[model samples]
Target: MYKKIRFLTILIFALIITAVLSTGFIYSISITNAPSKNSTSIVKDKGSENKAVNTKIKKLDSNSYNILVMGDSLARGTGDESNRGFANDFSSLWRAKAKKPIKVINIAVNGDVSSGLLNIVKDQQNLQYIQDSNMIFISIGGNEIKNFRSTDASSSVVQPNNEKAVQNSYLKNLENIFKLIRSKNQNSIVAFIGLYNPFGDDLTADKLELLNEWNYKTEDLVSSYDNAVYIPTYDLFKYNSQNYLAADNFHPNSAGYEAISKRIFESLKNFKN
Candidate 1:
């Protein structure tokens, strides 16, 4: 009877050891099958890394285009917000799509006339920029006409006969302007921003006719050069003059500048290689 009891006690101890081993094996299997929080975190981090790499590549691709702007108050961004003018917008637009870097040289001044610009371009420093530029923007003749009309009458009404001398002078100066730019860089694309009527409904019939004549003359001048183009801005503010004009009712507002930039950007498509 004592021997039988000893054998039974040994069997009970063996069963206890087997139960502990079985429980440990089950726990190990559960851990091996489940997804870990750390693994998910690693995947998210890799996705972010890929996005950063793509952005870097885009920046690298956009570093080679150059632009030059020569005009009056409009090019200087007098009434636009932050003075980030059309030149700036044009460069940014090109960079975004062309994926290439761009350089902008805007030498436009407020109240500048075409004659004054002709003299400015004669300077060696300015000539260097003209030669280096791939594109050139010009906005003139407005100050020439407006300043001339203002001296004779305080009224915004522009008469055809009133601007005869100024108009003649403007056409000559503009011709010289194109000649000067082409002399430096024959390959640079030139874009002339035509004058817009700021008087809205208050504009006189004579003034409208004068503006149309000026635009036509400028377009004719631009046609003389292979690389030059004329961009008309008269209709943009014709009916919506008040909304697009700044507080002075002369310069374009921020929204108006944006519209001009969009037009310029559209023209750029023609020159793309």
Candidate 2:
């Protein structure tokens, strides 16, 4: 951007000088532009700063807490090649800030719908893991809308229509999740990362519209429950698609995960009873 501005400045100056000499005009124009030498210098400085941050992240952490991460692929770090999804990476950072160990159990499976969560709930063994948990982070619901268990799954796949029935079902089950958690640990704080638009620029206009509608409904549903805070991760990746998502464009990348983690962390105060 600075280089382009500098070029435009030089071009304008040249035209001004030419007009002055050719027309014998006394009028002169002096265009003040960003120094060209500083443009590359600034770029180099940015690279250095980014490198410093990267180096800082290599250090081991020291803080401790019992953290349980549940839900879907985002919780599992699906898009990350290094598998440093938001939950793992954020737990590491939290440990770095604390003085004890942070016990983290991530029981998140890919393509876990709401039904899958219920099935997990039915299994007493799985629920025992988080019985003494200090905190739980969840990112389910995408799969609840997506069903792939049938023989004609491809053609039979009927995602949520954002209608009253579908919306109510997700909301009631979400409430059930909270109620179940409350039953286990009355004071455990749960944070649900809200769904965002998953369509690439490839989505049709109608699809985008439906996505927005469903996202809004989901937000409301999550907010309706007590002890459950729904953090919106949609807008983070909606416009800046490339930087926020994985190659599949469905799951979030490292940056996207970080953004969501940071938002929930910022809202951590509300989780306190």
TM-scores for every predicted model: 0.71, 0.65
Count: clashes, candidate 2: 7
Provide backbone clash counts, one per model: 7, 7
Error of 1 at 234 (Å): 0.8
User: Candidate 2: where are CA atoms >4 Å away?
Assistant: 1-64, 96-99, 144-165, 269-273
35, model 2: CA deviation in Å? 89
Q: Mind giving the per-residue lDDT tens digits that candidate 1 earns over 128-236? A: 7787777888999888765533323654434446577678888998888888888888998888898898866565566667778889998999888987778888888
Q: Of the candidates shown, which would achieve the greatest lDDT relative to the real structure?
A: 1
True lDDT of residue 225, candidate 2 = 62
Task: Give the range where candidate 1 is weakest over 10 consecutive residues by summed lDDT.
Answer: 54-63
Worst 10 residues of 2 by lDDT: 55-64
